[model samples]
Target: MSLIVQKFGGSSLANMQRVFNVARIVTQTYNQGHSVVVVVSAQGDTTDELLSKAYEINEEPSKREMDVLLSSGEQISMALLAMAIEKLGYHVVSLTGRQAGILTNSRYGSARIKSIETERLFKELDAKNIVIVAGFQGWNKYDDITTLGRGGSDTTAVALAASLHADVCEIYTDVDGVFTADPRIVGNPSKLRDISYDEMLELASLGANVLHNRSVEMAKKYGVKLVVRSSLNDSEGTVVKEVGSVEKMYVRGVARDNDIARIAVIGIEDKPGMAFKLFSLLARERISIDVILQSIGRDDTNDISFTVKKADLQKSLGVIRENLGMLNAKEVKYSENYSKVSVVGAGMVNNPGVASMMFEALYDADINIHMITTSEMKISVLVDVEKAERAVNAIHDKFKLGEINS
Candidate 1:
């Protein structure tokens, strides 16, 4: 039998009953003669609660200490899950990320997986035992614990599947599968049966929470097939692979990101390397930039505006304020009242008028677009946060994404 890697989200194992539910799922897979490796995140809201507690003690908690504290959530999930499997008479062992030989870069909060040592996993799997590994964390060269930030657990599961050469990497989430749009808001979004890696990458990066962007990157690189399914039931889920059946498709999914802020550096020198200098400063601080625009020089000066996550707004502003003179920028202006709406599909790269269709939809809805960015597979626009849902609905309806994906 082939090996399989399954990842359970926090909601899947929120409590003891859910832990037993997960164990039953894992045991069933193992009972069928296939070796099983399970990766799990912290139980429901455990990571958030940990952060709240940390903030209560120290307003600005150090990332290193936060890493130590946050890593405990997954550890708890792993242990309880292992015990649950044992109660069912299955031979099982739980391992933390470090104990499983997951090596990562030194970045405390958003560490990338450097490499995974598979000896420990192989040993346990060969002994006919199910292996449970904590997701989202790893050990750095300095032996300090580090995390992969948002969707880190998804990345962890994908990496493990690739390292162990598992047959499929199943990511169990709250939703049954990937949808044409968020069903909760769109009222009747359709689920996609399959999607390509490129399409999924664009959606994930643009803010589809179904899978993490880096995990898709790793899966594409390692040729690991991924399935997004619901943990609560046995339902057919969407498959993400190198290629899909729908090559003629466009607008596979519509995604929106509300945790966004736009910052404009006004009155910059408008010289060569000026933009580089300012962005380099943010990069040095590990702040991410998205949807950048530079206005034409007016009054012998230019304005550079860019978007970043709302959480990074303060740090980005601090960096800009600190390097204003070096950047030759006069002032920094920022607002957290924006959301990003994007349409993602591989066919967009080959098809024409995708952006025109999206703009037409927004025009009909009377939504004002602040900034626009288009890539080979996607078109993204910034709109008022309050109207983000309406924009997504308009765009989804315009493209008939539900019909095509349905």
Candidate 2:
């Protein structure tokens, strides 16, 4: 029998009715002669509600304790799912991350999977039993419970697929599949039939919520095939696999990040080590900076701009202010008033006029591009938050992203 590992997001099992829906889906797959393993996140808003409860009691909760508290959500889901499957007259076993042999490093909020010894899973599968494993939580060497950061469930699902060598990893979520642009932003955005792992990684990093970045990276490393389909429908969804050749790739797709903010370090002496020193400070504090751009100075001083998550603005700005004297920057300016919009595709490097067309589209709409950063697969531009919607629409239309209406 072929092995298939499927993961369901919180939205997939938001209520009792939804939970039974998931059980039915798994039961149907099992009846079709496939060995099915299911991974599941918490019910809708369970993790968030737990976080709020913890914050109400303590302003600063210990990370280790927080993980212990948060993991309960997935545990609840797994047990409930097993019960539901049993009600459907199927033999089922549910295992937590540790029970399923998901060993991870002790990073508290963002642990990485070290190894997975699935001996028990094999035994269960051999008996024609459907195995249900909780996602987003793992055990470290010290036996301490750790939560993989946000969307870690996606990572867990893919990692398990790699370990089990399953034929495919199905990620069931609310959306039908990965789209050319967020449909809410761009009307009738096209759903890609297939995408390469590298292109998917770029899209996820650039703000596509269809899949998580860590999961994409893991999939690429292990050559795991992934499908992001909807639990609510029978759509085939987007297939993520190896690119046979770099030539067969799309030119551009929409990515928008509203959680990003711009940080401008003003009036720094135009010197080589200056940028290094500023970034070093942020690294020391464990603040992630994305999309950095440096501008030439009119005199001998330059302006350096970077983007960080809006949630980290206060702490990151404080760190910059503390190191201001060492950086020798005249002023540190921060604006939560900006957003990042990117066009991602693996073929971008050899695609002629891609950048020019992107700029021209924005230019035609009179949308000013404040900062720009490019990687092999993607180019991101920063603009005022108010103009983010306009920019996405303009680019989507310029590229003729959806099916052409001839």
For candidate 2, the TM-score is 0.96
lDDT for each residue of candidate 2 in 1-406, tens digit (9 for 90 to 100): 7999999999998999999999999999999999999999999999999999999999999999999999999999999999999998999999999999999999998888899988988999998889999999999989999889987999999999999999999999998888889988888788887888988888898888889999999999999999989899898888888872346444647889999888899988887899889998899988999988888776798999888998888988999899888888888998888889999887777788888999999999999998888877888899888999999999988888776322
lDDT of 2: 0.89
Estimate the lDDT of model 1: 0.92
- The TM-scores of all predictions, comma-separated, are 0.96, 0.96
What is the Cα-based lDDT of residue 265 in candidate 1?
94
lDDT of each: 0.92, 0.89
Native-to-model Cα distance after best TM-score fit, residue 369 in candidate 1, in Å: 0.8
How many clashes does each candidate structure show, in the order listed? 0, 0
Candidate that would win on lDDT: 1
lDDT of 1 by residue, 1-406 (tens): 8999999999999988989999999999999999999999999999999999999999999999999999999999999999999999999999999989999999899899989999999999999999999999999999999998988999999999999999999999889989988887898788889999998998899888899899999999999999999998899999999987557567799999998999999999967999889989899988989999999767779999999998899999998999888887789999999999999988787778989999999999999999999888888999999999999999998988778743
lDDT of 1 at 177: 89
